[model samples]
Target: MTARTRIAAVAVALSLGVGVSACSTTTADDGPLVVVTTNILGDVVERVVGDQARVVTLMPPGADPHSFEISPKEAALILDADVVVSNGLGLEEGLERHVDAARADGVPVVAAGELVEPLEYTAGDAAGTLDPHFWTDPQRMVDVVDGLEREFAVAIDGIDADELAQTSAAYRSELLELDAEMTSAFAAVPAERRALVTNHHVFGYLADRFDFRVIGAVIPSGTTLAAPSASDLDDLTTAIEEAGVATIFADSSQPDRLVQVLADEADIDVDVVALFTESLSAPGEGAETYLEMMRSNQRLISTGLSP
Candidate 1:
């Protein structure tokens, strides 16, 4: 090759290399650093942030929000995050300390559930105590998305405000559609048959939204961290019998054997319907996203409750 041709080719290669480097640097710097406590909230953050941020979820897929514990490395990740998102309101019992530590380290810890209008459980002796499972209702999750957007804007400066606003608006519309679909889907069940029996008391918001009654739970508390006594199980079984609840909705993340034992002892022919409650399913599972999880649950509940 001529010397001129070699020089020209070298210049072209250098130009291409510089362009690729510039693009890579821009992408790395433009994406905001985000961290979520659970996979469920991670999915929601993904929907909101899209490609504008780098999101790290502390909990693995299908990990129980109430009982899943994180390691020191994960805890360090939380502490160093730009914004740490969590369901809050005690839903993440195992990671609450790490979240608090994150806050102590000056990381912004956003509690998505605190943005929602919380509902209280009125079953048995525990009346008027707030239920932490707000994501059960899609409308409440809309508020959570709003809170997350605000947090993202504050944490991710230099981002296009208009773009973020537009993204949030679009996500809000999707959430509204989900809310309407769930309302219509749940309405098909007969009113009396709308009673929900579950392994834990995690459906207060869902029951409130769809006019279903949460008859009883095997755990008898909003959180699975709380153990149920034999007497508590007896009382719940009695309530289930009295209410004639045909289905006990068990969390897919939790063991269903306890509920099976209860069902066998009751001998009431009640079916145990497994639903995604606290955490979402693994990718490719039907209930991987929050919207899909809610719809799947709506279908299961409505189908199980229908006459």
Candidate 2:
């Protein structure tokens, strides 16, 4: 080959080598290690992080956030994480200690619910406390997305600020759209029929957002671990009758025998609707993601509330 041709061939090879190296570098620096406490929050984190983080969810699909128990190995994984995201306001009752340990280890932990304004509930006799089930409100979840983006930026060092900002904007827009959809869906129901009775105090955020009153819960506490006394059930039955609540929503993960008993004792025509409240559904099932879960619950609410 001529000397000029040889020089050109070497230049081409060098250019291709540089391109391959750049691609490899980009791939290697793509994201950081992220640990999410539950599958529900994990879905939101995945959307915000996109392809920019290695997100690991501790809670398995279909696991109940209220009662989920993690192994020692899982705790270790959380301790080693760059960032740990939790639903916060007390959703993961069983995993709180693990999260506390992770924080003590100096791992950055973000509570998505803390970003949004929380709702406080006071049973008839107990002291008031903050409710942790915030994902029920789509707009509040937008605040969670914002918190997730900020946490992601801190967790994933060297992230392009422009890319992060753009992602946050896009996700916020989607959340606003979801909020509008939910508003329209619930608006079709008469205002008097907007009350909800659930297996537990899981819909406080939802009720607050959509102007629906949470008339009663079969279980009076936010977590299912708290059992309602017979008097609690009696009070709830009274409230259900007074509010004319037509449906009692139960968690699909919890046994419905108690809810059924409450329904029978209430002596009212209250239908029980099982919903994916604290956990995402298994793959191929509806409510597998945060958005899907909200949509599914909205449908159930609309159907139940319709005359």
lDDT score for residue 220 of model 2: 71
lDDT of each: 0.76, 0.76
Clashes of each: 0, 0
lDDT of model number 1: 0.76
RMSD for each of the candidates: 17.7, 19.3
lDDT of 1 by residue, 59-105 (tens): 66666777777667777777767788888777777778989988988
lDDT of 1 at 218: 75
Q: List the residue pairs that clash in candidate 1.
A: none
- Specify the poorest-scoring 10-residue window by lDDT in model 1: 17-26
**lDDT tens digits, residues 192-213, model 2?**
9999888778888888889998
The true-structure Cα RMSD of candidate 2 reads 19.3
